[model samples]
Target: MRLSDYTRLLALAAIWGASFLFMRITVPEFGAINSAFLRVFFGFVGLAVILLALRCPIRFNGKFRACFTLGMINSGVPFVMYCIAAQWLPAGYSAVLNATTPLMGALIGFTFFAEKLTLSKWAAVILGAVGIAIITTFGEAHSMQELVFGGLACLVATSCYAVSGFLTRQWINNQGGLDPKIVAFGSQIGATTLLLPLFIFTSTTDTSIHWAQGEVWASIIALGVICTACAYIVFFRLISDIGPLRSMTVTFLIPPFAILWGYVVLDEAISQGFIFGSLIVAVAVWLIVRPAKQAEEVKALQS
Candidate 1:
């Protein structure tokens, strides 16, 4: 990979890593559904502005359904899942779980996309499973019940991301690749549509809403504009430059930054189980990422 690509990867990891911090800050004040709605809603606004400035046609480029599906699975579902998780898990905990994306991606490839699973990948999966076990069983957290539910939510969210990665290669990249702005904008639009009613219902019913707090508002804008919108653009560029397989390496780098942010911003302490589990998950991602030489071939398999 080129130095610039490496820089983009690290930068993407940092932004996404901080998403956990932002969510942790905002979700409690606004509640999960409302917070997630704000995220996609603002993400749509940010991407729309970028699309206008770039003069990229906001209209679909022959793949409307695909873009919408990608958004619903990738952004809509996962955002809500993570928001719910943020209610219980610390930022670093959720970030480490995010590293499971490649593991889930590899599993999806092997099962549905006819990709070969090397022995290393099998070992990686086992290691990842073991890492998750250690984290869930032994990690430092307040409540075991909350930890279990939070961990499960994070897993489901990453699985959605893994599916979206494959779908992006199939539905978008193979069709000569949509402009990154279009994909980002369309996805956020789809997410916003899915979230709007939920946001409204929660706003009406949830008495805990704290729309007036400065921290709450700041985290909301940062989560949507910077983390979701800008991160998507950067991620799509990395996929264009380095292919999706290599683009996924960002997951491995996210946890440290997340742990750092948690420690500094939230005063969350790191435990040995968290450290060990995180290392194992990183190894699993590295192993899965190593053999993905052709992303399109793996993602778009014929029956």
Candidate 2:
């Protein structure tokens, strides 16, 4: 990777790592519906500006439903689930748990899409589960029940992300190299639309929760513009420059940075279990994303 790419990696990791912290701090005031709604709404606006500035073609031509479906699974559902998880779990906890996205995808792919899994992948999935167990069972968290439930919520969110991978491959990829920026913009719009009713209901009935706080709204804007929108731009740019395999390596950096942010900002204690579990999770992700024999052969020839 070039120095500039490395810079992008760091920025991406930092922004994503800080996302959990933002959600943890703001979700109480914003609520699940409100937080999820604003994130996508602002993300759509921010992405629109970038697309317009760059003069990127934003085509819809028969892909609206596909884009909306991707948004529902990829962004909308997962955001709400993570918000709910944040209500109970620490920011660091959810960030670490988010690493399970690839693992969950591997399993879901095997089961639903009939994707062939190597022995290494099968073993990696089992090991990933063990890592999750270590974090929930041994890592510092709330009550055992809350820890379990919150962890499950994170798993559900990651699982949705996993499913979206297949959906994107089927719907978006089959459409002749669709621009990811367009897909991303469509997704934000879809998520915003999906959350409209919930946000409205939450705002109306949840009168007891205060909404006048400046810091809370700031966190919400940061979540949308910086974390969701900007992160996606950086991620797609990395993929264009370094290929998806290299870009996926960002998965390894997020948890530690999240743990650091949690410790620094939230004064959340970092324990040995977190370190051990995070290491295991990173190892498992490496195994999951590592090139298979066929891919390595193809890549060798291409290179």
Candidate 3:
């Protein structure tokens, strides 16, 4: 990768990693559903502006429904889940758990999509589970129940992400593929639509929402515009320039940034157990996602 590509990759990871911190900041004031709704709503608006600026065709070629439904699963549900976790888990904990998406993807693909799972993948799945258990057991939380629930919420979010990946391939990529930017824009629309009624209900019923707080609104704007909208543009560009495999290295980079931001900004404690669990999860993710040809080359060298 060129220096520009590397720079973009780092920027994307930083943006995404900070999303957890943003949620942690906003969810207390906005509530989980409200925070999620505003995120996709503003994300939709941000992407629309980008589309207009670039004069990109808004055509979905009759795939708007698919794109929209995928958005609900990909963005809407997962965003809510993470927001819920933000109430209990530290931002760094949530980010480290988010790294399990690839492990969940491997398992989901094997079970539901008929994708092959090799021996290494099986080990990865086991190790990932172990890492999660360690984090939950040893990491700080308000209570045992809250810790378990928060951890489960993170897993649910990652599972949604895993499912959406396969669904995207089937619905969009296989069907002559829409522009990635359009797909992203459509998905945010779907997410916003899905959360609209819930947002309304919460807005009316929850009188405690801190609507006038500048910091809360600022976090929401950054989460939606920079983290969701701009990150997508950079990610798609990285895929185009360096291909998906290399671009995916951003996943490995995100947790460190998340941890750094949490410690530096939120003053969240970094326990030894958190560090050890994160390392294990990182190894497991590498096992699951390392390219087959690269693995084969390493094996040959060892032999």
Q: Candidate 1: list runs displaced more than 4 Å.
A: 291-303
TM-score of every model versus the real structure: 0.94, 0.89, 0.92
lDDT of 3 at 60: 90
For all candidates in order, the CA lDDT equals: 0.86, 0.82, 0.86
lDDT-superior candidate, 1 or 2: 1
Worst 10 residues of 3 by lDDT: 239-248
What are the root-mean-square deviations of the candidates from the true structure over C-alphas?
3.0, 3.0, 3.3
Better of 2 and 3 by TM-score: 3
List residue ranges in candidate 3 displaced over 4 A. 1-8, 236-249, 294-303
What is the C-alpha local distance difference test score of candidate 3?
0.86
Worst 10 residues of 1 by lDDT: 294-303
The sequence of per-residue lDDT tens digits that candidate 1 reaches over residues 225-247 is 99999999988777766766677
Q: What does the lDDT read for residue 84 in candidate 3? A: 98
Question: What is residue 146's positional error in candidate 3, in angstroms?
Answer: 1.3
